[model samples]
Target chain A: MSEATSELYSWRASIIKKQLMALTGLMMCGFLLVHLAGNLLLLKGSDVFNQFAYLMVNNPIIIGLEWLLLLVFLMHTTIGFRLILENQRARTKAYAVRSTVARGSKFAFISMSVTGPLMMVFIIVHLFDLKFGSEYLVVQSDLEVRDLYRTVVEFYSSEVNVAIYIAAMCATALHVQHGFWSAFQTFGLSHARYNRLVELSSDVFALVILIGFGMIPIYFLLGYS
Target chain B: MRFTLRIWRQAQQETTGRFVDFAVEDIPAEMSLLELLDSINRGLILESADPVAFDHDCREGICGMCSLVINGRPHGPGAGTTTCQLYMRSFADGETIVVEPFRADAFPVVKDLIVDRSAFDRIIAAGGYVTVTTGQTPEANDILVAKENAEEAMDAAACIGCGACVAACKNASAMLFVAAKVSHLSLLPQGQPEKSRRVLTMVREMDQSGFGNCSNEAECEAVCPKEISIGHIARMNRQYLFAMLLSGERS
Candidate 1:
């Protein structure tokens, strides 16, 4: 009974679980956009970057928002992993030789389960690399704040850092390619013809995540810092 | 055509099953897969050997009675065709065709190439019908359905309640089947009276039947004999969402 029937039993419970997953996933996607914008400030020099980072870390509302974002992240991952396990359990007896002729982004479609854990591991490693990494303090606006800009630049300066980031962003991009439009589909908003608009936007946003986050490590690796 | 057919064989509902190969010969290209099975069964009967048991009623494509996983693709090869309609020419002349029962917890194998699909019957029984009855035949024009809605309804109505969608789905999910059932009815005015109740209870039964959640992979749509689209699934989600939101109304 490790698999919660509530997760797969009732239509109400199942719908709510997927709804929560879509909501939390969209919230985190929004956070990724905001985080990308914040990190891009590193190009503006340590002073401006530290000033913004310091303000962000010190603001009570921002602290609360960060905690809420963590909660959302946890919810998305937990529901996703459980559903993956439950789905696999759905067919205990396997086909001796199974194949699918269904087309249209099947790699991204099936890769969600794989990318779910990849993103989790990447996020944990990413947090440890910067958020809880060695803190360097510098005077910004007549106050000592954590020099997150220097930390970021120094961390991404390594070729290893850049490589891991590129791979992580690729995985995220693959996941997002499906996850973005899938969130809308989960909410019952889809069109046979016009869903292409949402599907295209999903692809575009995935590219944005890849390029926006991916540029940082490569930018620093190119010795821009 | 000559071929080796590895057909699954099980004596009873509780018994274990395994593939038993038969080297079938002198099959005409025009013979349907089910007819080929008939020929093989006759040979087995003449030899006093146990014949392979499979489900097949109407040899035509529409009945949804024929079920087989020929070489992993349900209903054999070719798109939008059922096993009853699949001809021997679709396969290589001497290829080994592997046939197995549909695998899912909800669909236990009753015999060779016949998984019990009563779960679908139960899901339909739950809420797939309209409550109001007309004693006499009514004029079709009285309903006044939009052209597009009628087309979509007809499209969804094409689903034959075959378990091919369930067999072909990696998760063995029945969303496509249930979606088609829910949608064809929900799109019509005659079916409007119990719309909310229909979606809610049918989905509840589906969940209880031990079918997996839809991951939107859509192999169900691909392998469906009728080529039922997953768009109905999205519509089902929409209906289910509103049904849950408006549950207390008992519509």
Candidate 2:
């Protein structure tokens, strides 16, 4: 990042910042998709869940991927927060009476300024509780794996943990509701006729992420297999 | 028609302002909002009071001079029209109307219901034109343009530079305004010469002018008097990204 290169991007720095936000956020969304698939294995009970967890833990490139995921997450969160600050500077004075046009998702879309930071805080809490809280080892065959299923179940058996997880999932869902389509728009994939399809899929995506992850704590707490 | 009007009055940029209510009677429905203001100003002058100061030109809505945010929406209630084109019929009799200047960090209040929109002029001067001189409207048939591209270019060219997009956006973003200016040029063959350079320069100018970034909300489109689509914003995004990537390696 030299002066000349930085100057080049400064010509359209706002668009560049937006594109960077989209790119990093898109990578995290891809990870979320994969993570949702992995988390679904919990419903299969202890052995099945532990088997998937074993594969995840034993992968050779897992450390490299974890670093990359962390980097992407940090970049996304940092840019989003920076943009929020810039937006504040952009409008130092507020209108005495301001109103927005009638749009269904407008409220949720603007709520990204609030929900995005909440998602970051929630991610830290989530990783602390589930990823690094404790590890239980169990053997089924000739090898042993961490019984993450038991850890997850025991963690969610508490009302506080379930409440926090569910609440955070709602924020995450609100973030994706706008982020999904906004990413495509930033990438220049938006069109008049097909935008409805993209917007529809964004809503569906948000709902799936909300329910798919939200059901886990409830399922574990209720002792439902 | 009789109505109660709440109008913002700022004596100067450094001075604070508040709403002053005026009651008007026997207004004709066919009278344009500007004429209504004219009558109000005349009455004010008769009473030896300061007349309401506003902006207007061409009264037909083409000059992009009229600036007013009536009842919270820029250019009043009706769609695809400017403040000068707004008629008294748009509102109901005996209703109370609130009028304010177009609010933004860049466009500050000049007086009663007038904001300095000169930032748009600077943005346009950045690169919103084709340097290639065609001298005059030399035969339109000579340079062939595809029907669809020509239509799209015309659509983007419809922006009036009213600054309503910024006023309507929650972040006060000028993306719709800049996108319209960028897209109007990028679509034509004449604009192809300076395409990359134009978008880069104009968008940079817009950001430096203290406007916020678009968050993909369609509120700008909803309030745009010319009905400029956000599709141009998408087109501007594509143009901007490709321009950056193509010329990025040089720096």
Which RMSD values do the candidates have, in order? 2.6, 2.7
Against the native complex, each candidate's DockQ, computed on alpha carbons, is 0.45, 0.44
Residues B149-212, candidate 2, lDDT per residue (tens digit)?
9999999898988888998887788999999989988888989888888888788778888888
Per-residue lDDT tens digits for candidate 1, residues B1-251, read 89998888989878887778889888899998888888898989999987788898888898888888889899988899999988999999999999898888789988777889999999899889986665988776876999999999999999998899989888788889999999999999888988888887788778778887776767888899998888898898888888877655442
How do all models score by TM-score?
0.93, 0.93
Q: What lDDT would each prediction earn against the true structure?
A: 0.84, 0.84
Top DockQ hit: 1
Residues A12-72, candidate 1: write the lDDT tens digits: 3455567778889899889989988998888788888889988898899999999999899
Question: Ten consecutive residues with minimal summed lDDT in candidate 1 chain B?
Answer: B242-251
Enumerate residue pairs that collide in model 1: none
Find the number of clashing residue pairs for candidate 2. Answer: 0
Native contacts kept, each candidate:
0.44, 0.39
